[model samples]
Structure formats: structure tokens, C-alpha cells
Target: MSAPTLYELDPADSGIYRAQMVTLTDKNPYAASVYVYDEDEYRTMRLLVTDDGKAGVALKGDEIVSVFAHKDCAHPKSVQSMLSQATALGGRRLDCFDTVLPDLYADAGFVPVARLRWNDDYAPDGWDYETFRTYNGGRPDVVFMAYDPDRVGGDYTPGVGEYVEDYDDGIARAQRYRPS
Candidate 1:
């Protein structure tokens, strides 16, 4: 098969990308909030769409506050394309979960900074085990990784206008990964 082509969607037309991402939520729960961005912030989200995949990123100056890849397009090449585009657009620091493209991210110089586990033995601070179990949909461990830690810190904690936490507790605001 031919390689999938990536297209950069206009910010004004990002609704279409959001709609597509929502459709994937049935199988990939993380898709529900992958592209959620605060309206008040001066954040410009660059969403890259493909025939079989998609990726969304929000860059505030050089820091990447939010980033996610559509389940369908989380493969090596597609992910490489997404990362390349993000880097070119001034995303120096990336904080994302390793639920999807863990190997790819590692190959690209990302290191694990935190691990989110539903198990009480290793759960992060303020994590509601039962709530995370439900929200995570049986995915036991979600590893948080960061790229370029020397320049940008690998803090997985959500910031304002970045990730929306539907639950009342301190699990990841935007969920990632549901096994197929």
C-alpha cells in the first residue's frame, strides 16, 4: 500500500478534525478530549489529519502543553511525521502518554517521566483508583513521557486550558489508550 499522506488542517476548520477524533472514542476513550483547548488562551492548535490517522498539538511559544495521536494513525511513520511537524512549529517540550506510540516516542528521544497506574501500589498523587479504573477502561498502566527534558521539564500534570478532567480527582485530564 502507498504511504498515508498528512494534511495540516486550518485552525478555523479544526472542527472537522475534532469530529473525526470523537468518532474514535468508542474504541479509543482518549479520543474524547485529545483536541480540547481553552477558548480564552492564546493557544493555536495545529491539527494534522490523514486518510487513516490524525494528530493534534497545542503550542504555547516553545512548550507543548497538549499533544495526542489518533489511534488509527499512531504508527511509526505517521507518528514521525506528526512529531516532525510539531518540532518544526516550535514545539520544544512534549508531554504525552505512552499508551499508543511508546516505542516510536522512545525512538525519537523521549523518556518516561511518570507512570499512571490504577493500582494503589503505584498510583500518582491524588489519583482516584476506582475512577481511574473506570475512566481508563481497564488499561492498567499509562506511562507519561517527555521529549527534550533538559530544555523542558517532563511534568505530566495538566495545566489550565490544556487538558480537561471530567472526573473530580487527579488522574490525567485527557485519557489515553484502550486496548483493541
Candidate 2:
């Protein structure tokens, strides 16, 4: 089999692509609808379509901020292709919360700078990371990663660590902590 083609959908045909995405993929309805209704956001959407699957991504400036795909279409190749296209188009950072894609992102040269887990008690004042629930009402831990390792710092290195609850404090500690 061949790799699916990933491309930017024409703004004029967003509605058509939106419908196809909804019916053909198991993407989150609420997330996919944003592109369908928001004209400006639709311009940043990238889509992957093949005989057997579909995938979508929404870019926030140079960051590939959101991604949704049909279950069958979320293969490594499709996701990798999307990352390659993002890099070619100047994507520099991404925060991956999904359990599966973080590995793929790491393989694409994005280094994990911090890992976050929700803890209402330890969370900082006015912290809303836990409040932004997914469509299924779950808050998966977020992994803050950067495509350019230099963006974090010269001393920062990639290594596994325990999940941190306080976003600000966690990031500061994570940057200084190196796993054994």
C-alpha cells in the first residue's frame, strides 16, 4: 500500500472537506466543526485522505496545536507525513496530550521539555489546564515538546521523568532535572 496524501484543503472547499471529514473519520465532532465554521481557521487545516482513511490537523501559527484522525487512519506514516509537512511549513513546537502520538513526535525530532498531569490541589491559582476537558471529558497529561531542542536551552536534555502537577513549578523543575 502507498502512503496517504497530506495537503492543505482549499479555503473555498472547506465545507465540502468538513463534511467528508465528519462522515469519513472518527474525529472529534466539536473540534472538526471549528474549521467548518471558522473561515480563518479553516485556512490552517491540513487533511489526509485515502481510500481507507482520513486525518486532520489544525495549526496555530508555527505550532501544530490540534490533530484528529479516523481510528484506522492514525497510522505512523500518516502522522509522520503530517509532521514533515508542518516542518516544511515552519512548524517549530507542539504539545502532545494524546498517549500514542508523543512517541511519533519524538521520532520527528521534537524533544519533550516537560510532562504535565492534572492535580487540582497542587495546581497554581487560576490554572485552567484541568478545566479544558476533552470531548470525552478527560484530561490526559500533556507533554510539552519542541522541534528545535535549542529552543528550551543548551543544558536541557531528553529523558523520562515523573509527571508534574503544577505547570509553572513543574516546568522549572523539569528543565533542571535529568533522569538517571
Q: Give the best candidate by TM-score.
A: 2
Q: What is the C-alpha lDDT of each candidate?
A: 0.46, 0.52
Q: Which sections of candidate 1 miss by over 4 Å?
A: 1-6, 29-43, 51-77, 98-100, 113-144, 148-180
| Model 1: ten consecutive residues of lowest lDDT | 170-179
Please give, for residues 1-180, the per-residue lDDT of candidate 2 as tens digits.
Answer: 224566666666556556654464344423322223254455555543443436655556656644555656645446656665676676666665534456767766666766776444543333334344541134455666667533322222334435665666444553443323
Instruction: Provide the TM-score for each candidate, comma-separated.
Output: 0.48, 0.52
Question: For every model in order, what is the number of clashing pairs?
Answer: 0, 0
List pairs with backbone clashes in candidate 2: none
